[model samples]
Target: MSWHLFVVFFASTFFISATPGPNMLLAFQYGLNYGVKRTLWTLAGLSLGLFILLLSTLLGLDVISRQSPWLLTVIKTIGALYLIYLGISSWRDTNNSSLMSDASAMSAEVSAELTPNPDRSAKPLPRSLSSAAVKSVPNDWILFRTGMWVSLSNPKAILFFAAFFPKFINFSAPLWPQYIMLTVGLFLSETIWQLIYTIGGKKLAGWLDVGERLAWLNRGCGVIFILIAAALIVDVISTL
Candidate 1:
């Protein structure tokens, strides 16, 4: 690729990845809860998922676009439903703060009952089901599956690949080199922005010291995700 083309690709990729989306939100949540390390893990998983999606598209899996409209419609419907489910689930999860409070209160009561000396201060136990855990280290399979599904199933992603990825290629030039350039540009942009998001999230985590505060933050993030998911659903439906 020429230097001018490379710069265009870089600029486009950077701007697009830096924009807030489900991937970035999840990465930020990962950073806020599990710290930067696992966010990186999550980002790595995301990269792998995107790479596979791109490769499949390059291999003409998208030829199904000509073969069957119903199949594509089903895929879009599934994606839309998934986004709606994520939104509703996140919105409903805001009530988790009460659960945390109850757990804390129960722990205090248990500690008080167990202690013979009333003068001794009772220590609170760590919550088993923490917002940080749910937001950050999702169940292993779920994390991987989410990465794959979010990247592959989203109609927006398919539209993006269809409209954007092909624009950069020179059909006469060697195919391998163009693929390599696109892959490098795409993954590098994704990784760099995700790292920035993870670092910012860690910094935010520092402010959320108390369990109640963290719980509130988690709810707030959940709500934000829900809103984003709702928008995604709308976008999908409009396209359909």
Candidate 2:
């Protein structure tokens, strides 16, 4: 690929990656929950998923998929279930800071009411701040798996890759070199744009710290996941 062609590929990928698709939305959520550093694990998983999706497309995964209808159903089912699992996880999660804030507010209210009646007999324990930290944290593996689940579960992603990749590929020329170039160009562009989105998410999260409803955010993300899964399932049904 020439420099101009490379530039075009990068620019095209930038727009594609920059668009607020499911992956970007999840990444934005990761940024809010884990910040940029931890969000990289999710990004890494997504990048790996993308590589697989693109490679499969180039190798004609679509053709095989077309031949076997059951395969498509199986994939859709798995993806939908995985998304539901993620949604449930998100729905149940609560921010530690939010918990701490509530605890503090309750403590103040209790203290005000009990000042005169000094309850020396029995006093409840204030929550340990250390425990709050633990409740807020998640391991890297969970984040990585969440990213992969989103990428792999979307049966449409492979189709998108199949459709998107061939526009620039030259069959007359050696294929591997073009594939390599596309891989590098797309990954670089994707990483840059994903990082930008994540940073923006983190900043927005900072602004929302005072009034953020983390539970609602999680539920919203979860609902979106299920909706995407439903859409993919619908597509599968229509194709059949």
Candidate 3:
């Protein structure tokens, strides 16, 4: 691809990745609760999922979906149900002790501040309890599967990649290299952004002490996800 085409493609992909979506939000939650390292794994799984989606679409899976109405319907139902289940879990887990584990860390910091002679020169603070909670959750195979399921189950994401990936290609030349660059760029940029959010959220652990604020944030994201799932389900039913 020419530099101009590459730049435009990169810019567009970056912008799309930067938009706060379910994956990014999940990354943030993972980062805030787990820690950068584990979240990195989640991010890896997520990137892999995206790449698989791209490859599948490129391999004419979209054509199959178009030709098989029932298949698409099945995907839509599964995707919507999965999203709703995730949303409800998040909402219910708002008060999960794991989420509140950072409370002790914050208390320790406050206690140290109150002491007359706290150590002036200590090593950099370790990750917060919130991050520890994330780490404590057994990510194992389930996280990988969840990432893959969420990415591949959504027909909308497939439609998105199908519509978007081709626009960056130059039909005049061989397409493989362009595909490689686009897929790599998309995956890297998206992964990096999620990492940034995950790491950034870890730094905001102090704010976790404010239970009200944290609850509000959780509820907000949870509600948005629920609404998105509802809309997707409605669309599915209407299509049926």
- lDDT leader: 2
Candidate 3 per-residue lDDT over residues 1-240, each given as its tens digit: 887977866765665565445576667665655557765776767778887878987566345444774765665566566666656765665553332244335323323443334334423334655333422343345445545554555566776654454445544466678778877788777877777667775455445435655555555545545665676677667766
Which residue pairs in model 1 clash with each other? none
Estimate the TM-score of every prediction. Answer: 0.52, 0.54, 0.54
The candidate 2 region of ten consecutive residues with least summed lDDT is 128-137
- Candidate 2 C-alpha lDDT tens digits along 118-227: 33442232253233222343466756766776677678776555544544555446767887888898888887867866778545444435565555666666665556
Candidates ranked, most accurate by lDDT first: 2, 3, 1
lDDT of each: 0.54, 0.61, 0.58
Q: On residues 1-240, what C-alpha lDDT tens digit does candidate 1 reach at each position?
A: 676877777776675575445566556654555556544656767777788777876555245445664555454445445544543554454333332233234323432443324322322223643542422234444445545554554555654554455445554466668778887888888888778766774454344444555445444544544443454445456657
User: How far is each candidate from the true structure, as Cα RMSD in Å?
Assistant: 12.3, 13.6, 11.9
Model 1, position 157: C-alpha lDDT score:
66
Residue 99 of model 2 has an lDDT of 32
Q: Which pairs of residues collide in model 2?
A: none
For lDDT, candidate 1 versus 3, the one ahead is 3
